[model samples]
Target: MALWGGRFSETPADAVFALSRSVHFDWRLAPYDLRSSLAHLAVLQSSGLLEDSVAEPIRGALNELISEVAAGRFVANETDEDVHSALERGLTEKLGAIGGSLRAGRSRNDQVATDLRLYAIDHMIEVAQQILALQSALIAKASEYGDAPAPGFTHLQHAQPVLFGHEIAKHVQGFSRDLDRIHDWLDRALVSPLGSGALAGSSLPLSPEVTAKNLGFTSSAANSIDGVSDRDFVAEALFTLSMVGIHLSRIGEEWCIWATTEFGWAKVADAYSTGSSIMPQKKNPDMAELARGKAGRLVGNLTGVLTMLKGLPFAYNRDLQEDKEPLFDSIDTVLLVLPAVTGMVATTDFDREKMALAAPLGFSLATEIADYLVQAKVPFAHAHEAAGKCVAMCEASGRQLHQLTDEEFASIHPSLKGDVRDVLTVHGALESRTTVGGTSPSSFKQQIKESTAITAAYSKEFTDKAKAFSEMMGA
Candidate 1:
């Protein structure tokens, strides 16, 4: 049954019904809608808008409907217009006239806004937890390969030696910030829009606080118009998830490069690698490739929803329906990518010797030489020039920096007269970075310790919130 029809003499055209149908994608909001209905029923009864006799059976039916929906026994039919319509149709079928009274002070506008927040907040917490799981995998792998030296790049060319573990830990830092963004997004998302009927709130004495607490919102919306129209939470969620996708893409890009035959610095497990359609020798990094490609898709989803929102006036609009598919797709994409990429990182093996061999190439140790000269009291400008000269000389002779003889080093500068070759090895270069957050073994180990603590703390916070949500929902 249509929600509004008494004013219209004729039924809506088939094309109009088909074009406006949302149950196809929005049936996923069924459980949240049902739970919100239970909360609404409580308010209706408390405010005397609904008698206990009416509210009691409606409550029982709503709960039963939730179970049926969960069990896949009750679902949206071709006649159903949207999740709200489909659910109201189910309720009316059960209680006759009484089921229809639950709509007393609510509108589809506020109901949908509330449903989306409930749905998004639930999934965002899950996504944040999945991110922490990925962080855990990286921490484990970093600990496994402590102080294993690798070439660090600037402009994709070798610039310095870094511990392989340090490179892995850098992704964790980006993901940690993503978690912070999710936490901040929750601050705004935790408000209820249920009582903000249509645009202006109802004149009825409905207790919004009761419904808000029942549905796990920290408070009800203060302004009815903003309550119904605001979708900043959705946009922020997209931005946060897109950041996650971008960070995942970075990992994908680096892993794809490292797995190449020419680089061979890392190897993907057979389970994670894919065979080429035509080339028999291929074990392609398709997982990483897809991860890299999905970043664009997530960004596109964010952009589309924001554009849809930008032109609309305050209060609810049909354009707002455009928000769900993109938000849902982004959440689904991140949930899918996180586990696959985490497995790829956790199971893959690294070739420490291969990475080490490339560590000192492109004169990556030139900075080490420059720093060595500065320690001997040479002016930094002169030291930088001397280091540049050494690189130029090595280029002319087609020799590596370590191959330079002591007499040659002495001829270049007075500070190079002694055991200047001492700082030339890859191990020496890695160890020289002894500062906090540096590539030294001590710093790398300390990083692992801190990340482990950080992951544990975030994991705890999510766990606590989940418990609070369960208690609030009476689950």
Candidate 2:
């Protein structure tokens, strides 16, 4: 019989039982469920709802069940409705009548809520660690390539020359914001929802604070209905992971472009690349392609959960059962992909000569020409027009900006002196923008230093939290 089947005239149909079962996906939460049970049992004993002797046996049985599950000796059976039901059966089988007291002041509604929060907290730390690893790889690459010139593009056309490190720093800064979002979300997600019962407060004088502290939560939920009903934390976590996927996709797209023969700016390492079956010479960036493709699935998971929650009324509902898979998938996909992506990045070989060769193509020095006119005290609008004329003149003559004769420059604008040739070189153009956050070599080196420090701080934060959680779980 089902756990809640006392009022039913008959057992659920086989199809209904199979369809309603969540053990396949939620068995991952079995440990978390058992942990919540232990904490709730303590709350019950402290409130005098259960004898200390009864609670002790129940606790001992739960500890044994935890060991069994961890060692693969215990698992949910065919009749088990969910992880909670499966573990309840295990506890009952171990302690008989004493196990029945463990459920006195709790319901599956609040229980599952608490379990999911614990799952989120644990995985959030893991995902943050993976992100930090990726960042470390990026920083290592930037350090290796220090100020190597590359064409910076706008709208798929070469717009200016920039250090390759500058481009890597942009992604690093984006991931820094992602880390901030995870930490901020954890602040709200760490609250415990135990003792909320089945969408209402229990009459047994249960102390939510005791359960919250026992389970490592910073606080307890203030409202019973919201405690059981709210899945905003799951949605937020998925959104955060979606943003991570999107950032990774952007990096993948760039790697794909850079590895193409036409660009020839970088090569994916042999270990991370694959070759075609028919074409013997094709070195395919399969890792980057897959990272790009999986981003869509991550995004889809976010929308799937959001759509699942949009029309539901407040308080617990059966539809909430749909939440776990998408959350699980998002976490799994990110954890699996990030390490591979990190390897792909860390092992890449950049062709500095090729990047430098392409850096100043397509009249990329036009901006520097305009800035030269501005430095000569020409009106800003006139300087821009004069620079446009220089590009037009170069296009007409099949010559680059630096190749134009002084006579030809003089014809375009009076400020176009021979000194204009100085700024036309790629290195000169890159160095002229000396303001903070520019692509100059000095600016890029400073950025790499700052990014390294920030990454170290985040690494420490994640490590400290992981240790604290481990200590709490052991306690």
Candidate 3:
């Protein structure tokens, strides 16, 4: 029975246990519970709520519990209600009332909230590493494929030639933004809620700052009711993870398309691809597909949390316990999936031959051809029309615009000269794009250098954050 049941006349129906039990999901927070106890016990002894003689045994036993839980020896029953009661039962069994005295200045309300927040703060840094690993894979692939031409598409139609590296590099920017969000969310989730007892501040003269210091929070909550009740920080982290997952999904979708037989320009590595059971010859990009599908799960988890909190009133609810399960699920899904994706990306093979062949098929150099006429003093609108007509001429007959003889070119546009063919050759078209941020080889190499520098800077940032988190955890 719960500690509070002594005041109730009747025990809750057995069915209430089924509805209210969160131990199965929240068991993952057992380590955080032990850490909380350590902090609260420290403050309790310092404030003389308990003598050091009492606090000493509680601290030692709590450390042992942490090891038990870490080693997979801890389990709680429905009667234990949750981790808090389970830990209390363990302490009471070991040290008599001294264990019970540690709960003096705290309530399960603020305690569980603090545990959830601490758990989130630790996990967010991990998820950020997975994001960084994905980013590293992308940067490596981008740098590897520097200036390897691929068809750039808009609205699913071939629009122009682009270095394959630049296409992959664009998503590096998106993931970097996701990294930003992960840190911002972690910053919010790190606020401490330990001293908000029940629906009010503790009657004991507890110092929240001391507890926050012990648990690695920069500060403690300002309002007692809000501290225990508000889970917006958790929701914020989930929402950010959802966005990162979505971005991965979008990248996965592109890889799926690229790996298909219809578009053989990109090949999945053997480790990342799986063979169909019935079709021995098939090499499907299963990891990519799963990453895409898991995005929906993360998005759904975010929605589940948001829906749970939408209309609820302030302060804690049984519904708030619903938060941890979805978060754990989403984090587990992504962290497990991202490393595989990083491997897939790191090992992907770029089909330079197929990309080069496909590069010229859609009259991809039409804009450059237009610029050719524009440089010859033709008005751009007129130049655009003339380029369209040239495209139509190639489509009507079976000859490319570049294949037209000087006599053939003069028929389409009198301003066109024989040397226009020199300007339209594949090498010429790729070379003449000398504008900043253009597709020219020189421009892409410059872009690759700049992107490489950014990747190095981001690597240093993530590495430092990881070090700081390690130091804070005393790991």
Identify the candidate with maximal lDDT.
Answer: 1
Clashing residue pairs in candidate 2 are none
Q: Look at candidate 3 and tell me the lDDT of residue 57.
A: 87
> Root-mean-square deviation of each candidate, in angstroms?
1.2, 1.1, 2.2
Candidate with more favorable, higher TM-score: 2 or 3: 2
State candidate 1's TM-score.
0.98
Task: List per-prediction Cα lDDT, in the order shown.
Answer: 0.91, 0.90, 0.82
- Whole-model alpha-carbon lDDT for candidate 2: 0.90
lDDT of 1: 0.91
User: Which 10-residue span in candidate 1 carries the lowest summed lDDT?
Assistant: 466-475
- Runs off by more than 4 Å, candidate 3: 376-379, 405-416, 425-438
TM-score of 3: 0.93
Compute each candidate's TM-score over C-alphas. 0.98, 0.98, 0.93
Clash count, predicted structure 3: 0
lDDT, candidate 2, 343-362, per-residue tens = 99999999999889989998
